[model samples]
Target: MNFPVQQAQGPDRIGQQTAVEQSRAVAEVQAAIYVARQFPRDVGRSRSAMQAACGSMALADKAFYEFPRAGGKVTGSTIHLAKTLAQTWGNIQYGVSEMRRDDEYRQSEMQAWAWDVEANTRHVLTFVVPHAKFVKGKVEALLDLRDIYENNANNGARRLREAIFAVIPDFFIDEAEELCRETLNKGDGKPIEQRVEGAIKVFQQLGINADRLEQKLGRTRDQWSGADIAQLLITHKSLQRREIAVEEAFPQARITGAEITSKNGGGRKQGPPDDDPWAGQPTK
Candidate 1:
């Protein structure tokens, strides 16, 4: 059940591994499950459970499976404990695939939004095609524009929403309108440092181990890249989507926001309908 040797910061990825190395990696995967199963009592520490499982798996993969492994039999797993480990690993592997699929779905969903955020830079550079001298200026301009986009997306979608309503072709207006209304803006994220901390905290909520993720990346909270943050948010969104879908598909599973709010006693306190802000919003 022991973890594989690791660096002070993280596991050292061996670029190319021999057959022995591959066998050991599989061994480590099983061993991780063995250690992780001992954490079944982690009721409030779901992240810790995930950490033990994923960290082991990630460490094993990082150390030996990143590249083509030498051909060798998957070492012993016929024993009871080994069999259990193998089974747990399969379950965890499937969960990992689900996580990956969720991330990909969200990435594709945001493709157009990302283009919108960065498109102004391209508009400014339209006349500067194939020029190396403008590189520095272009880079700075893009950074400046991106900062502006960040500010707008965080503060409000007013500018971006208006721009979309204006520039989007007539044919796509309906679809684009919905996207504009729902896209990333209106405090979807915080500063990178704060977001990193929030992202780490969210691992437990998502049943992912923060310690395991940290070990996988070989870095602490602040070390996560922009891409990492995107993945975390996307994964979280994916989980939410699945939960919503499940609830909708099954009547018994339905959990309304108002119900949850009422139970928690922290959401908007119900009052007379006349006081509602949306009460004045015309249905049209």
Candidate 2:
């Protein structure tokens, strides 16, 4: 069976794109980016992101193939060896075909080890990575405003707009949150009812079934803390949340929730990746 291979430039051309050329390219982009100070701030972060998007390992077999750009061919063995080479050596040596034939790396135990690492990685991303402290901090700050408005609904209602634009101005998912914030900001402006109702309306527009949000919080939208919205942001892409919206939204896993909780509690940071929904295609 042939596996779908990752598209790679011809191995020969890989040499052409040298460290000097890469550095020059980055310098040029950085020069233009430095024009906006924000770009400079993200320079290191964006580069790391680009690297993560192209990590090691790939499935092998006859059905898979990726064509090279310069009319040069990428042989099947080259593709297979590339996966092992990427993982074992931390880099792909030019003559990978020899390694592919090496029986030492092809043993059943070696394959099992590779898969064990992959499985644990998937487990980690599913249960742990999503609950990042950085995201939680942002959500906490967004909801913290509820405390201020608690003392005086009148002044609290009046100060919402200032809080929104001045404090939590950026959207976590989309503009719906902002719309909800603006609605509360512009209401008869007291007791938070207008803000809550407006948020439900906006969330509905965003395809979130917010009909029960008020009931869940035990207060109409105005009475609920922004923490509810913040929690939504953190777990918006959660398997359970996505499953509620659509059947089979996530791949079925043998791992149980308690298992994930236990395994994740120990701070492992890896797992096998899910299939890319948008493969070799653009997504809006």
Candidate 3:
């Protein structure tokens, strides 16, 4: 077996593809075994074994199916050997991918649970009390308050808990109390992007960023004219309705936030005051 081993920066997505092309016949047989026979599930109870088999099968099938007319048995054997080596060397990559996928699936389940909790929380709270919108200024204030509560060593757990309680509405607090409490006890993970990405996944699950929102909001007008303002109002109304539905559906999740309407609020009432649209705009 004369397989070319790729330098391990990460899992060999492109390199594996090249190997597959060079050994198509053997690879097709291996892929057939994987997809048709369910070799991974049947091989062993351990997940590592399943991943190894799956990865090997992928390499094998790609090689066998994409081989040139002249490529022979030696090429097939080489692909098989490379895949076997990858099973050992790329275990961490496989495990991390599997784990992240599993986490996403679990997050979906949690979002459903959060939605149910929100429905109940909103029903109970809306009947008893009314709360105003937390606009941009409020959002900034809350973020600052949260930072203080979270960062302060002298703030103590009780004070921090109180701060969180004050920041969220009673309607939201009822459902999110447990979640916030958990966050207070166990701090959020590092890498802001990961946490935000996880939040976006939940946002996706709730149909917040769905084509539904896009269709309801639609596209903005070409100019910052009255037509654009009307469209903005229409989108704002649509989003307002969604906010209500979201609150009534998922109280635990923080879906409500300030949306950017004007890029420069104080600077300009409308788009460039000049008639020339590209006056200040740059050339490519």
Candidate 4:
């Protein structure tokens, strides 16, 4: 009986495959550049479309992120906003790609790029994302595939946002951000009181209580205004994206049982345990 033998993939075969892939990628990019040059974007129409999109309360809600930084909250446009601008502005190629994975280092190298095919301008950022998470003031290795992927994706998304902005005009981004803030402040035509209540419910689902939110804002829940609610909405988006942790957004001090009893008139309410991931925070 004759048996068929399987041939091993040689170095030459690997090299040829790499070359073919590179050639294909070059061709795709060139084709895009040609198309972009042929049909340039209309600046006026693009700007108008971007403004219309930013004026939407739904899009505005996800268009920005805010996080505590250096004793103050830092606000900025998010990946969602960047992507929207790229689409509306036209003739842009933008993406993030995982270039390599090193098991020994437990990290992945990612490449993010945005190109203005029409203008032949491009911005690229390459960085490494560790397969780890900070838990309880310690770095913990990620063992699950899903967790590692999420970790990389979260970091990559931020870098991709940067790359997209680098290619886009700074003035355009600023204008869109302003429009989004105005839309967020205006809200979905709900009364301020109703909106506050709705925002509280949303935060509650994320393990943040009214007390914590009040503390974060340095005011009572009743005192929260439309502007304050708008800021909280941006912070909520940041937390949901994993760009900032709950502890960082709303820090609470540790209260002893005695302290709790004293503060609550001897009826201590149950709180998260010391070991809880979202416990032990104090707001500024």
Candidate 5:
């Protein structure tokens, strides 16, 4: 028996798939709205929960990031804090999505959205992220799939933070930030000297010496306060997340053989420290 050949339906099939996806998304949003209207959040309870979360030292340490912009430092809450607040606040849906990819441009058009399901308020941001990184003041293409995904995620996270904040109340955010600052200043039950030492060790692993850090803060190590240590921790978190480059954070710091020896105790260079100061601390 001879089999009949079938004609390809490329465009039609893709169109159908796109329609189906759009319909599914619409249905999900409708369902979310319905559920939110049916069971609205308690404002008092949500505020209390968010305040308690912000009171965590570990969470507060990673909540904010600072980066230099136009001769001044810009500081703001990070995606980690936004997500935590969204969860604690309840009745919210937020996420980042890649809407389209342009191989020719080496970029992806993305959207970050936050929907206040209870209040029916929504915030959406549409932007593009280049699949490239700055290395030594040069733009370098990200060839690896993992690298591309990470780059998108890092850029998406910043936008997502903004979207979530736009939906949440500004007063709530302000109060939470104040609580976080208070928590950071309280020192996590550890002595100030020990906390400072741990922080210095952490930065040393990143090829930054205590002197460079002191220079960045314009203070001596002995004169550093809990607030200063908190700032350093935030900067350290930013460096780890690649939100800011090492050179940008510590412009004067240069890795030399002597510095490497000091970090490694005059031994071979190794990986990051296995013992994290905030290891046992709760993130949220």
Candidate 6:
């Protein structure tokens, strides 16, 4: 006897589109979580982790941007690798498929369900989020800097960015805690919330919203009990006020709270991420 393959019902195209859009949002959030896990800036030896983080971002790049450009033939392997890395490192597996399928809506919906469930699992892994967040942010910074360098052709800025990128994955993860402590003592640091918020704003201004990363952070907070958004706010502030380097700020704060909650939970909590999710996809 052979088991029959399952397929999504196709009576409603409109509904299917809506579902697909929603699922994509969840997938984006999961991609962010994977980024966080793959890069832990608060540790000593995390080159491997940094590489993993880059891999996830590359997947996001392919799925949302590259695949569409390539006539939709970039393959789902990128997404699948991203989700696997996130689950393996982040302990946050919001619906990721290893098998390839056609229904984009199903993949997206699975991600959405996983996001809901994983958000509640934060209590089990609060300590890991902060470090992971730093790594993820560094990866973003590096990527952004690369784009800036590529587009502007400024030798000075390119050199600076390249130097920063080269030392990033190792420096922050190794010295984040100490760096944050020093900055905080200076009473001139910018809070983590502000930094993250500023970072997001800048990206959005540049037509690159890091929706998934922010969503994953939010989900982590939802799941964890001891997680504190204030810690992130404080960290970012400490860096800015003290004029601390990104190398320092990147690892000091955890993404767990800031990624998910309001600025230090000071204001109203943010709503769920519904914009453009895209975490894991199966390979056919």
TM-score of each: 0.21, 0.20, 0.15, 0.79, 0.78, 0.17
* lDDT tens readout by residue for model 5, 83-145: 988998899898999999898889999999998998888999999999999876699998888
- Highest TM-score against the true fold, candidate: 4
Clashing pairs in 4: 251-281, 251-282, 251-283, 252-281, 252-282, 253-281
Candidate 1 accuracy as lDDT: 0.35
* Tens-digit lDDT track of model 2 for 1-284: 99999978776565645867988978965554445333222324533432332231112111122222233323112223223322332211111011112233221111011211111111011010111112312732222334323322322222322222222113311232333333323333344454455556655654444534543445555456554543332223232322123212211345555445444377543343334465556657
lDDT of each: 0.35, 0.32, 0.31, 0.88, 0.86, 0.35
Model 2 worst lDDT run, 10 consecutive residues: 122-131
Candidate 5 weakest ten by summed lDDT? 268-277
On lDDT, the candidate that comes out on top is 4
The candidate, 1 or 5, that scores higher on TM-score is 5
Q: List the residue pairs that clash in candidate 5.
A: none
User: What local lDDT does model 2 show for residue 168?
Assistant: 18
lDDT of 5 at 258: 57
Q: In terms of TM-score, how similar is model 5 to the real structure?
A: 0.78
Worst 10 residues of 3 by lDDT: 107-116
Candidate 1 residues lying further than 4 Å off, grouped into runs, are 1-189, 215-219, 243-284
Candidate 3 per-residue C-alpha lDDT over 1-284 given as tens digits, one digit per residue, 9 for 90 to 100: 89998877666456777777868967754555445334322213333442444333233222121111222211111223223332322211110011111222221100100011111221111111111223433733222433433322222322323322332245432322233223322323334334334434545655554323333335322212333232223233333433224432222222222432366554423333223668678789
Q: Write the per-residue lDDT of candidate 1 for residues 1-284, one digit (tens) a residue.
A: 99898656445544455657998978976665665465433322533332343333222211110111133212211112222222332222211001111222221111111112212211111111111112322633222434444432322222223323333234333332222222222124467777677777876665455654564456776678755655445444434533122112111323456555555587755432422568656676
What's the best-to-worst order under TM-score? 4, 5, 1, 2, 6, 3
164: Cα error in model 2, Å? 28
In candidate 1 the C-alpha lDDT for residue 136 amounts to 20
